[model samples]
Target chain A: MRQLIVFTLAILVSTTFKVYSQEIRIVNYDQLDKLVSSTKDSVVVVNFWATTCKPCLEELPYFAEAGKVNKNEPVKFLFVSMDFTSKKEKAAEVFSKYNLPGKCVLLSENPNNWINKFNPQWGGDIPYTFLQDKKGNRTHYPKTFATSEELINLIKKELIKQ
Target chain B: MKHLLAILFLFIVSISIAQTTGYKPGDKAIDFSLKNIDGKNVSLKNYNDAKGYIVVFTCNHCPYAKAYESRIEELNQKYASKGYPVIAINPNDPVAYPEDSYENMQKNAAEKHFTFPYLLDETQNVAKTYGALKTPHVYILKKVNNELIVKYVGAIDDNTESAKDVKKKYAENALNELLQDKTVKEPETKAIGCGIKWKKN
Candidate 1:
């Protein structure tokens, strides 16, 4: 009886840990495209950030809060990390530490080849947020520090217009 | 009426912010006197004898900037004698990022043995005027008949990760073209680097 109880407790703990530990998806451009195109008639907030960027860290919580607030809304938040492939572990650790909401993925694409694809005028800087509509058409791509309210308002404006 | 005025004011502010998205190719470079690491003020006008200038907006803490430090030094070593001297500047706010402070700039200049004038853009006007979005951003300005012309604006090369892997030396090529009295083939290119730490309003 004692052995059975111990085995059951161990099994429960392992399962709980496995469920709680969210795996950070390491994705190429093709995978990123798939994720961006997954949902229809939804406002997607694709935030390009990294562990090394201080401004990114400062605003990420606010961004997470925005995601949580708009959970029921026709909004989808994607935290795409621009950290190097070598810092995959570090990026994952930061993601967990921040408890960043929604789908979290590390983009492994070489920026030189794809920076302009996202936006022609994009200078490949962090703390950049790309707000897109249901059809994957970009509504706003602010390449600077943006507050949660500003992000939400942008989304709302787009949603109303569309 | 008050609400309408507030909305109008907000609209104007937004318009101004949109206007600051920064300099494109062919825009005349804004000249300013920024303090160099050597405790002397430097300006584009000071380089009257030079044919052109390789203005690089970079900082200490940025890994990409550090990566290109050697290449920047070599650029100065080769070009400063050849009329197109490298003029590096730190356009980041020190309070937002302490590593970008003037003192750190001096230390970095000494430690790295930089041959060019490493200036501190305290106001960041020069950087904004040039549309410098990231560290290690380059703007190759040519001196033509006492007027400065923005010949090229872009990255030092295609690869910022490794200097050896650089296939296209964009800035170098532009300078070479200028030296040969020819038009620069590519006017602008983008690079991946740390964003310039702007001070809060």
Candidate 2:
């Protein structure tokens, strides 16, 4: 029984490590929108960023920290990269360097044709974020960057409302 | 002290008044004297022979800006003889993006063989006052009654990724309309671009 318990623990540890070191996925805007809209019972925090955007790069650690602290909570943080399809590898390298939490998706679309569709308030700028409850209600934060405390409060506020 | 306060209040009032809606169509554009790549000051006032100006806020590193660099040059080549000239400005802070520095600006201009005046808004005051939110932002200004009036604002065209596939030429159309003595039907547009690199205070 002790051996069996040890075996089970080892399996769990291996799986967790595998997940931690997993490579991020590259997804188009349609696939991203579908995944984000399908999540249930969670407060979704979606951040639009790019590898070249200095402010976006600087603010990822805050989101990662918030996600780590709220690992067990019904809060989801998704990073939607605005990098090109050809730069998928570069974007992945940046994401791995930061070890950002949750799923990071690369939006391989012409931003010119798609900026307004994300939100009318979006001025096609990076570091734009959106907070949403399980009910699909959304709040847009069209700023350059946000703090972990600000993100936590936003998530908590949305969770409470749910 | 009272005199100082009065001057301060007037300064604040003038700034607020000049920044009204930020150069919408029919609004008079604020002229600026910024340093050009040739190490000389240039301004709308200096373009005495120009009928209009394509004031583009762009930089060296932003992909969108790079994509439009040739097109902007083409704009000046195509229209400057017709009395409209392209005036490009780099508003990005060099501290945030070193590739957008003044030296790089000169290198990019040299490599691209830019005919237009590529200027530097080192303080970024012009960008802020114009309410420019992103790189590659365009403001088409027309000369009317000895004043430069903003005729169109926004993207150069509808497509940033592919110039050939573009269906609408927003800035070009506006200029063409102005040349024909007609008002622009679509005076504004928004395109995806790198946000301006602002200096950290």
Candidate 3:
């Protein structure tokens, strides 16, 4: 009876760990550039996120699910985390804790540089997403988070624009 | 031509209203007299002939502000020599974010070797005047034909958390455009940081 209980507990712990460890990865600037360049033909969805941002965490699963649904399509999803260098470990832990998916990269530059590059008027607010079509028309959807329907609609719109 | 005229008209109107209300592009910034770390006084009017001014709302405690401390210093160093001096202001209510207290501000400025005046807006009137809603919020102003026309308002950069994946430099771009007498492509951006810790109303 004791052996059975121990075996059940071990299985549950291992299962939880295995399920959660597949979510977050930290890539450098070169990796990010490569990702962006590689997805030139597809509608690139880049979502800016941070661990401290509650809405970012709340809305992450929807993006993972969206990535799954569009796996066969010419759409690529990139989750660019704005977590500070000091909190990389914490961000990684949270990623495992939340089981986030899609290609995740930790942003390593100052906020002032990219806010305007993305949209000269962006204020470095996150969970902001920048969606672009093949025609080079880019739409910056800077919001707290998007519902699954909202995400789907945006993806569909980008695909249509292509 | 019509668009130019409309912009000119809007610019004049925005300037007139900014004195008593919201800050918009082309507005002549109002003068401010705020106490410095050593109880010294500082004012925008003192630099009446300055080519431009970079008024940055920052504090001692915010992680976002801390992330750009060196960059802010670098900006001040780069521009102050070119006549665009930076004025760092602490607008957080001490009661709320205790780390923003005057004492801590002094310590942080000293520790960071800040070259600019770390002005303390005791009444926070200067912050309210500028509608500065967050730490690290920046306002770049230029003396266009002797009128203090605002050239830029927003974040200091794109990536505050990390400096590796940054794509554009907003403050620098605004400064360069102003120097060349060209319109700033991006004038204003949303200010993101720890929300202003105003004295609870």
Model 1 spans > 4 angstroms off: A1-31, A108-112, A143-147, A156-162, B1-21
Q: TM-score per candidate, in order? A: 0.83, 0.82, 0.59
* DockQ metric, candidate 3: 0.19
Q: Per-residue CA lDDT of candidate 2, range A72-103, in tens?
A: 88898888877765677787888888867777
Supply DockQ values for each candidate: 0.42, 0.42, 0.19
Q: In model 1, what lDDT does residue B158 have?
A: 77
Superior candidate under TM-score, 2 versus 3: 2
Worst 10 residues of 3 chain B by lDDT: B189-198
Measured with C-alpha atoms, the lDDT of residue A61 in candidate 2 is: 88
Off by over 4 Å in 3: A1-82, A85-88, A91-162, B1-21
Clashing residue pair totals per candidate (backbone < 3 A): 0, 0, 21
lDDT of 1 by residue, A21-132 (tens): 6667789877887888776798888888888888888888877777777878888888888776667778888887886667689887556567677677677777788777
**DockQ for candidate 2:** 0.42
lDDT tens digits by residue: candidate 1, B74-111: 99998889899999999999998899999999999999
**CAPRI grade, predicted model 1:** acceptable
Best by lDDT: 2
